[model samples]
Target: MPWLARSRPLFPAALLTASWWGKVLEGGRAAPRNGRCVMAPVRAVVRLRRRVCLQRKRRVLGPPAGPEAAVAAGAPGPGGGSPGQPRFFTFDDPAALPARTPRKRRRRSRVVLYPDGARRCRPRAERRSSRAQRCLLLLVAIVGFQVLNAIENLDDNAQRYDLDGLEKALQRAVFGQPAAVARIVALLRDYLATHVHSRPLLLALLGPSGVGKSHVGRLLAGHFGAVLEDRSLVLQYHAGHHCPEARAVQLCGDELERSVADVVARAEAEEKTPLVLLDQVELMPGALLDRVLGLLQPQRPHPFQNAIYVLLSGAGGAEVTRFVLQNVTRAAPGETQDEAHAGPRAHQTDMELRAGLRALLAGAHPLWQAAAIVPFLLLDRHSVVSCFQEEMAGEGFFPEQARAERLAAQLSYYRVAGHEFAVTGCKQVVAKVNLL
Candidate 1:
């Protein structure tokens, strides 16, 4: 009852008891207790409470009053609290109000390694799509670089070799000497072929110093559009403080050799042959001669294998002297020799100059068999007159002179020198000219 007092309102209980007492006292009006009489109010209060409890039960439990409905209707619980009230949640009891299942966490998308060892991140289509873009960029870069390289190569090829300058200079220098000029130009043409098959050639210009050996070298190099290198300078540089024979080994030690090798290598790589004009080549040693001779040999391909030519120019006088000394003995007790004194000496000079050149052709007879060895040594009359009139006359490198006066003076001297040498043809012409 004490517990009921705490649970239910006191007024409802008091009203109930009062209604019960009225029911007993109004027995005479018992029929009215059932309806419109003295117990009607009490019955009304009971019906109202029943409706209230039913409504509360419906609200607490769902529509058809469950255990929660009984609690709302004031049913007493064994634990002393309202029946069906919630307590602590226990996962250990399966029947305990179905453990409110934790909402499932959304599955996270992740990168995974496949059994085949490939990375499976994006879909196959997406992966291939991106990879193709990168590959295209790389291919573009490679193609661009190759194109740039080709353009640079073409530019380098266009660089001038100065052939025009050489041609003009030679034309001016040898105006009247057409025959000599033609031979030289032909040799230059052979020397300057920019192919590997054509070999280099030797030019042994034998004459006194004032006879224009230097001019010939310059003209040849100029004609071929080649670089003119002073052989003496190379010799001095390589010889250093050492001997000539010993100098060969030290060539590798000098930066000059490396520089030359680099130039030759670059020429070969570019498929352009380079011609080298080495003046005063006689001063160079036999070993160096052998190397150059090898290049001139027909069987071997041109050195640097491009448009390369090496023209060797020097005083052949010394070479001639050596040849004569080696071959000829003193005339037998003053008996006549083929070339007594000056004859043997001159013959020897020719032989020496020829020997060095012959040495170049020795083993390569097959290649040289068909080639002509035309010996040319003359300045034509027209070229001489042209030089005297244009270059020597105008420049005043010689005294200015009237045409007839110059002619008479020149004719007088010519007759004198011609009588001394007694040589005819161009020799007579040169002797006459020299006297002038």
Candidate 2:
């Protein structure tokens, strides 16, 4: 009776029916025990009747609010039972559902108070100290000073020998032999870089007679003449001109020895490296080559040690000609056009050529073993035309290209690989220009 007081007024019939069931279940009585009212064993069954009465009351009225509202308004729960199945206070009842409560995350606090923004973090320490920075600066300064000194020293040495002028003059005078000119300049640069020397520098200009070997010899003599400020310091001896076949061999040897002795003595006194140009050395006697080789030895006088000897010989002319012909015949189009891409191949070819010439000449004369061999290649048709034009201009002509080409066409050439190479080179250019 006390629990029936909670029954809704809108569901009087359901409440009354459920109350009758609750009374039957409880036997409608609370027994007196030890002078106190006590609940009967059927108290649980009475509570179940009350819950069922509530559910019936909810169905008669509108659905409850919140999670229970969906349970009341929606269809029956899963595992819908038959009419004979037990229906008292099962989880399938719509009014028994509980409301959902989301779980809370266990997050830590991120915010904190700081006295000052600038000092909020520990200051990052430098990897190096002030003393280390000073040492690094001092090292940089010393390295820079050393590099500058080396560069200045190189420039002074090069200027002392006038290498720049010599390279330029050789380039202007010599054509179709860029490798030869470059090697010659590089050798001179290396040798003249320092005043001290272990032995003399002997550069053998080996090529066929008209490939500007003599012209290069002349240019070197002229340039060194102005640089040394003493014509006596430059000795240019032509075997064919200075010592003819009619002259006694002993007389010629003595004359050459005396001239070299005087030049070397003067150069040593002046503390300079004299230039000795020996032209047509292929025609020179064996005794003369021995004498020249003696001067290049370490046991020679101090003056001999400080001199530069250039031997222009035609001994390797046949080899140089054969090498050029074979190259022209076998060379690919790319080999002639793309030099940068074919650098290794070209360098290999040069090494082979130098090796071949060295082997050939070294066998003939021991002096050539120590000499720097510069091989002059054959001149092309264009270089021959240029030479013709140059000779013409020197002879006070207009130096017309068409006229020069016409003159160049008269010369003989060895045609190979769709190109023409002058057989006589620029040797006959002077004679042809003089006739005009």
Candidate 3:
């Protein structure tokens, strides 16, 4: 051992320092020493000691003794991860160490944010606001729908107005059955629609008393957007009165006439439709009708020709009486009566009326003819009932069916020889009474 100890100093300094110098030195002493100083054996012992010390030192001073450390230590040698480690590493094998498994990540839950739960709930104020908005939208929709409907109705040609009321009023005046009244209405509507572009000149409504001629004329005026006036009304306007009067004036004032003229002038200037519905037109002098006829005549390219719709409502043959009285009354009663017997008298009267009508027609163009003349037949018994029923639909004052039957019966009684005249020459009689 002493001899081997002497060779301990020959061991590598790396082995001695890495493996703990004392332990490395002690292990080296096992080497044999010969009298001849065998350097080969000593060198071999030194090499082994140096390798052991290096490994021991690396294990002690390197990373901690964990899986990571083992992996780092067991990593590929100087070349790479192949078969084995250095021969010196055979003494220390830590390859049995377990590997580290990856850690599982925890998930965080999400939080929902609701600022005001009360508002989210159906609060009274919110509900009220929503309801109000809905109602406003509904109202707007309704108004828009109504406007569109009105425009469409105005454009429709197939649409018809309620004529039952008119028929009842004219049941006595019409000359035919109630059913004929429908045809009259259709004709009247067609005429008005076609003649909207014409002016008033010699327009006349020839029918008997109680016929709806005056009434229909008024309605036509309304349709034309006309301002209407009668003889009395005209006289009132001439009396310097701005409003209608209940009575007529005995004396005609020039100033009042001028005022009436002003009104007419203003009506003309304001671009309004002027229509005079003379109910008792026969009362007026023949000269007046003649003048009216002259005005009614369609004028070619005449300015303000469309501004008037002369509405003369009179009983048939009434014009003849007025014509005679008007001219005869102007002369001495005896002289006028004597002239009335002359053949020239009837010729003159006919010429005069024709002249007036001709003058009016002259002013009116062909376009005005359709609208200017509306000769209507009166309603019959059944028409009277139908008209009454229509009127009853509104005012809850009467039973529609019963009232219509009663009116029809009364109208039937009034017709002579089973024939009735239309009240208004404007519309035809649709209802007829079969007395049998």
Candidate 4:
């Protein structure tokens, strides 16, 4: 009872000691009042003490260790129950023990032993092998393809001019001058392909009065004027018409400068190229030629530099006629040009003729020095006949070949080297055709 009031917990030995004290103090020899024995009081007190000690042990240590561990060690515990009895969670229960936490293990590489030494290599991450050469080849192929494509495109720049049409027109219009036509077309094809030019193209068409120089000029002017779709852009500067004997040279020069400036400036503003045709340039005064030459200078502005200047002059006519009569072979009826101006010899003669003409003109005026001199050779009787037929056809007349031959026979010719070179070429064809 005292232990209950105090509420102090004790071990099983303390309980037994407490019970014995109670027995000694209250002398378990008490007389029985009714049928109860004095030993009954002592037994009740012993039971109460045992129950208190059991509660103290339960509080001190959480559900103890498993009974299997004690049994394995061959030690009998206070509550190591037999296998047949169902195990309760107690100081002997294996299930009641706290679980152990698992730990992460670090990986260590195996030692690589060699005859001479030992080495430790760290594990590497997996990776694909390099294909640098194959990659380089693929890159090269791509770049080369792009470069080749770009090269092919550069040739396409000359396509817009319809050079084929222009070539055909020149061939048909300018007879007895296939080489000249080809040269003009070639030069134009090269120049018009791209807009950016270092200096203006100076074309000097040097020939006599009858040799289709002015005709070519007119054809070109018409073609370009039509192509550009702007008549104002084509500047036709006829030396005889523009700068007459009555007009002052200085005033003519001023007018020429202003007109050229206006045309080039307007064309440039419109992002277009202009053609400046100066026909009968030989008749042009030196003062005017100087002004024109000044415009052709490299230092000129972009507008002035981007234009084309053609000089149709009869300055080297005598030299051209003399060369044709002396060096050129006679015409064999249908094959005069083919027989005379054929093969490499004809090419050499043609080159020499042009060089001579260039030298002759360069002495007369410094303008010719910078120009691309295209000498118009004397036309043969066959070319003159063709010219007559062309003019007749153009003038709404039936161009009968026999009638054209009869008409061409009327014209005078320089009979030399088995060929009849026309003295006045197709110059008289237009007049003759008009009469028909």
Candidate 5:
């Protein structure tokens, strides 16, 4: 009778029991036996669960129309408000709520100062010191290498023979071309003095075979302390066959440029002036000749600024010889020779040489026209005799001067018309001396 007095007439006991059992199972507790009243703890849990469910349903369905409607729908008011007044909920202060166990903050590694005034992170200091040491070591190594390189360069420069001595040596080594020798020496002197950018020294050695064209180049190479036979800095191409054909070639366009650039780069890296000797250049095809000339053009920066190009051509050899012979002073019917006569004759010879060379190269490219033509004159009997003597002395073939002179005299000399001619120049002389 008491339970009936507290219970609402609209509420069903079966629904309440089922809901209570559901909440107990949801809370991970076993449901009690059937037909038994729930315990006090279970009843409190069911009351709280019912309150939460009623609040959620009110939110979704919106608030009931009035307290009577709420009570009729079996929705309890907060703190069991009277049926006449609207229910109002109150919240406890966040600070007054049960304090949560404070989560422990992870301590980050930090650089701490010790009582001894040293940093606590020794590894960081060690790392910094090690990095500084490595940088210092690298810098020192770089400086040392540069110093050694500079010293080596200085020593090399110091060891080089003076240009004057080199010129004299070249003159002695190459015979029968005094004018050519003097001009070459002057050219070299000018090149050394005024190394104007983009203007490389070009020498065209024009003469017959065995007239010391190649020998002059060798002398120049030796003067510069470079080995002419070495193909690195001194590029020697026998243009007759060794030069690549213009159309039928492996390396062309960019490949050709790269190859040439690589060679020039190597010479520059070694601080050496590249010397290019094109032997029998007249025999080279027009295309290949143009390619070589393009390297010397001034439009772009090139390693050829310090380079020396020696072009050996036998094409104009006959004209050179004829021009030299025609300029020889043969007193015109008792005209007395004097110092004035000597100057005029020398001037006339130079004029004839230039004229002849110009005529010979008129059909060729302008590049060849701009070159300094050095005529390697045919060696006279005297020069050839001297060459023979020098060779004999070198080989220890003739310790006695008398034997060398006799052998030189016995060598057959050719006669063209009335003038004496050493047809093979110093080549035959050297051979004759070697044979003896």
Candidate 6:
């Protein structure tokens, strides 16, 4: 009764009407009336009734089987599911899920090889140093090449011969041709003054052999600081042997043309005029003569605009000499002066000589029309004597003036005649003096 009195107040009036409540009340009546014991059976009976109620509720609503069931029952899912937990759908076969592509692995680069079969893994500093060295070598080579070219082009002897020196040499070296010397000096002056023009100064030296035609060319080259012996700036071509044929193949082939062009181009680059001496020009082939003439034409493209071309021809030497001798003097009856005093007469004679020579050359070849014909006069007995004395004096032969004069007179008497002068001019005289 005491246990019932303690338990009856704690149980709800609704649960007291249940069978387990009725059993708990019957057990309470069997206990001692005065004892405050036997409440353990009542507590067990209440726990069994609560478990039975939970089983009945599970049967009615069904246990949670999926994510939806878990969410609806408010039960915690995987990974700490709370009230607002995000539910993940589970696939039975993992293949049903979207596939994840595997990542690509990076490949290592291969080493490069050098020309000597060595690996090319040079450091940055070493590579830069090698590049700088190559550049330096190239620069040094370029500078050396330029310096050599400049040195080769410079003419050391050019400044040694002046206009005055040129005139003195012409007078001393070339004898018995006063008119020729004057004309040459004048022509050179004119050429130097007007060389900037397009046309070249063309001279036709017409006379017999050994008449200083080639000698004059040599003197001019020497005066201008050109190499006379080596034929660098002075191009000498003897038609008969040197230029054997008109055809390029027969005349040393293509090499000859290249050499000529190279010389002219070099002279032009140096701002100097080149001298082209054509010896025995009359003997050259007509085709070759025409080609040479074409270079002087105003409309043609040629490297000889700044050049001085001397055509030495013995073709009409006799005719030239006959003309000079006939017109040597044109004095009046009262005038006993020499040919030097007859200024007007001398001018007229020169004009006639040039006209005659021009006519003769024009008859043989048309190229002579562009040239100024200059006659190298034949040396007289007096001029021959003076030439012999000058040459002997220079050579240290016949040092005494009186002895030299006597030897010169004897030589002139033996070698020269009254009407016919020395054909070889001073050439044979020099050779004889050398023998003495």
Taking the tens digit of each residue's C-alpha lDDT, what string does model 6 give over 1-436? 3444444443552354455557767786453554324455556555545455555555666555555665455555665665443565665644454444444679989875568866667688866767788999999999999987665534232332245677788888776666787787778666654335588888888887666787787777666653333358777677777766654633543434455567677777766667777788877767677777766778744565777888888777888667645644453433321234335666677677777888877877788889888887666555566667777888987655665455555543222222435555666767767777
Best by TM-score: 4
Distance from true position, residue 213, model 4, in Å?
0.8
Model 6: how far is 267 from its true place, Å? 1.7
Q: Tens digit of lDDT per residue, candidate 2, span 1-436?
A: 6544554442454455567558767987543454321333234445556556656666566455444453454423334633333433444545455633444688999977776644665435754468888999999999999999998987786788889888988878777777788889999999888766889899998888689898888999999999989999999999999888888877888888899999989987887789999988988888878878878889877777888999998888999889878877455553431232135565666778889999998888898999988888787787888788888888899989999999999999988877777898998999888887
Off by over 4 Å in 3: 1-199, 224-264, 267-272, 290-304, 317-372, 412-436
Predicted candidate 3 versus true structure: per-residue lDDT over 291-336, tens digit per residue: 4345445563333353334444443434433343344433333332
User: Residue pairs in steric clash, candidate 5?
Assistant: none
Q: What are the TM-scores, per candidate, against the unseen true structure?
A: 0.36, 0.64, 0.33, 0.66, 0.54, 0.54
TM-score of 5: 0.54
- CA lDDT of each prediction against the hidden true structure: 0.44, 0.78, 0.43, 0.79, 0.64, 0.64
lDDT of 4 at 76: 47
Residue 190 in model 1: shift from native, Å?
A: 4.7
lDDT of 1 by residue, 68-101 (tens): 5445565544346533444333345334434333
Q: For every candidate structure, what is the RMSD over all alpha carbons to the true structure, in angstroms?
A: 21.6, 16.9, 21.5, 19.2, 23.0, 21.9
Off by over 4 Å in 5: 1-161, 194-196, 226-231, 244-260, 270-272, 330-344, 399-419
**Mind giving the per-residue lDDT tens digits that candidate 4 earns over 354-396?**
9999888888889999999888888888788888888888899
Better of 4 and 6 by TM-score: 4
